[model samples]
Target: MDDVSWKTAVESRLDFLQRENLDLKAALKNILRENENIRSEFEAMKNILRKHVQDTDEKCNRNMKKSANKEIHTSVEDEFGIDPERDGQRVARIVPPSTSTISSIAFYSYLSKNSGPITAHHTLVYDVSHINRGNGYNKNDGIFIAPVSGVYVFHFSVCIGGSAYASFEILVNGEVIGAVNEESHTGMGYREGSNLVVTFANSGDHVFIRTQRSTIGYVFSNDMCKTSFSGWFLTN
Candidate 1:
């Protein structure tokens, strides 16, 4: 071959290689652009998921806090017999013994006044008398001497105030038949507890209530809330 023919062939080959290199560069640029777009989309999705989780957590925490506070408030109301909407304290229910029978042996009495700071083993003398049909309960010594031999139902309630506690025992002839314990744990307001006793007694058996263990606060009594005791004959 001649020198001219050889140089022309070499030039043509060089041109072909340059075009291929350009094509390759274009393809690489396209691939880099696609990778950048994919990365941006991935970052956006991550941000959306993170925000959703944060919002959900916040909402759940708020709901849980609200429910917990409501439960606590309800518990306090029920325990203390407080009616928050009426803004009045609920009085304890005191149903007088049924007066159906003409010969019913029943009595009802209450403190009617605040008595307090009583020592342990002190007898609670219910100062006021509402009923003593059989003439058994003595307001002076707070003792009920049975007027007739029969089965009796006795109930007593004790109220304590001012962050203190008191324990009492309903005694029959100097024996503990039932017990009560009341405490005002919040250092304010009052707390009350009661118990009932059903037992047989002779005509002269003595029944009374007295402090036991300890007494730390004042006992409360009034028209709204009364520390009281009562007993009725159930049967012979």
Candidate 2:
């Protein structure tokens, strides 16, 4: 109502607004500082991840180079009867082969295929339901043919139901390399034996497993991790 009273009220209102403004500015500053801290932490994490990835890639490259170096041909001069220094030279660097050769093939069984209840004694061939890499194995004929000249590793598992006796021999090119047997069971749902052999093979050599000539039994091949046969070419 009075001029002096009006002026005093307006000044009081102005003082209150100035205090509120200062509070708002302080809040904004705190927000900006928090944002900067988060950004710095985020940048630090990104740098650490990048460094880990870089180290892993460098380690992989070093391992690959070391593996390649180990693949170089070593001469066996004593077996060939030529002087170690005379027949062929060993090279240090990795050289590309003149001819490309197929070197990898593997197969595994997944289901039941009967080996034999037919004759008193027979060679066992496995059934093929699943194959992993290559088809060097003939599931129909129960034989594996090498796809390249190399040392190969072969594994055969023989599982059988309640039976008198069972024995299997692993054969490479018609010669027995090794054998595995399961025998003398009074009560059995399933019994298994496995054999592994690492042997030299030329391209097109055949490999298989056969039951002993007098053992009258059958191999149980199934999806239940029973009888399965697998082989892979190791090196050429």
Candidate 3:
């Protein structure tokens, strides 16, 4: 082979190698740019999540403050007596106590064990009596007898197992006032139901909870979830 021909082939190979190196560099640059974009997007999402959590915390704090400030004490003048300046005549004005006193009556009871496959018109016996201030609640019979004639507020909560449905009725002197129903259709879990009722009762009126219709599964009562009943005298 001639020297000039060999030198021309060598130059042609060097030019091809240089072009390949430039192409590899361009591809690497593109990959680095894409990585930067992905990193920025991830950071932005993290910031959004952080802001949401912070807002939720702030909202909870504000609600707690409002609850704490709901009850406050007043002076003796605010408790009784009428303002003659407003009506030009004397009228009686009496303010109730802010907290529960010795005269007030309240009771709270819960089921210590689970009740199973309750039928229609079955009574729920809350065996564990936590607070029976006036001895109005009977743990054995699941009944609350009003100790004094007044307006009363009653609350009850019931939890049922998954894949079942149950309905309960709050009774005052054998009359239904309110009802609670819980239904779970899907997987194995727990569902809860609660109801509140306000009624006027005499001193001997009876209040209780009973099953409305057929119940599919058992009621749940455990450390995590409790079936409870409570009542308090509101006003006379």
Q: How does each model score on lDDT?
A: 0.85, 0.71, 0.85
> Which stretches of model 1 miss by more than 4 angstroms?
1-102
lDDT of 2 by residue, 205-228 (tens): 988877765555665666654777
Order candidates by TM-score, high to low: 3, 1, 2
Least lDDT summed over 10 consecutive residues: which range in candidate 1? Answer: 93-102
| Best-to-worst lDDT order | 3, 1, 2
Q: Please write out the lDDT profile of model 1 over residues 1-236, one tens digit for every residue.
A: 89999999999999999999999999999999999999999999999999999999999999999899788756656566555545666754343223344256788999978877888888889978899897889999999998877799999998877778888899999989899898787656778899998999998999999999667767888765889999998865
lDDT of 3 at 102: 29
* Model 2 stretches with alpha carbons more than 4 Å out: 1-93, 96-103, 114-121
RMSD of each: 20.5, 20.8, 27.9
lDDT for 171 (candidate 2):
84
Better-scoring candidate (lDDT), 1 or 2: 1
Please identify which of the two predictions, 2 or 3, would achieve the higher lDDT against the true structure. Answer: 3
Q: What does the lDDT read for residue 138 in candidate 1?
A: 96
Residue 121, model 2, lDDT: 36
